[model samples]
Target: MVSVVGFLFATQARMPDHLRFAFRILTLVFDAWPYATTGKPFHRLDLPRRIDQVERWKRSRLAFRQGLIAFYRSFVIFGLYSELSKQDADRGMRAKQD
Candidate 1:
């Protein structure tokens, strides 16, 4: 999931300006959160920790945070589903080969 998002951002030239802007905002908010005294970015966080933060913010009353969370979440789910489907297809092929 992280790899997909990272790839999209790393290749920002291929993405529309609006989409890039949304991603930047999402990243800013995510990274700016105070995870600990070390002040490391959210991308440095483990998957489970990041998920916990997203779940917490999703339930918050702040509309901006919720919107960002929703946008971020859509990409995550898409990446997860896409990867899962590909893995399933690969598994099926391997099974057929046996």
Candidate 2:
């Protein structure tokens, strides 16, 4: 969320008010997609935890944390992209063997 906000703030000074508002709305939709399902407002909801709540709750704190980590992991230097590049290189090398 901070990253998205930082991006918005960095561009705000030069961007017109209307465009900035649109940018803000778009960024919010990306960030809120996971929690905004089931047609409910999730920001104020208290999530449940434990076995009984697994299938019944909106989202537990653990899931929120994990999802956030996964989101950042995709773009981090040594995360998804790096791993994907390594896999691609290995596959190319193996293909040469045949």
Per-residue accuracy of model 2 over 1-98 as CA lDDT, tens digit each: 23444543554545788866765664454445446454433343356422222332224455544443343333343444556787899999999998
Return the top candidate by TM-score: 1
Q: What is the Å distance of residue 55 in model 1 from its true position?
A: 2.5
The best candidate by lDDT is 1
- Residue 94 displacement (Å), model 1: 1.8
**lDDT agreement with native, every candidate:** 0.73, 0.49
Model 1 score (lDDT): 0.73
Q: In model 2, what lDDT does residue 11 have?
A: 47
lDDT value, candidate 2, whole model: 0.49
Candidate 1: minimum summed lDDT over ten consecutive residues — where?
A: 1-10
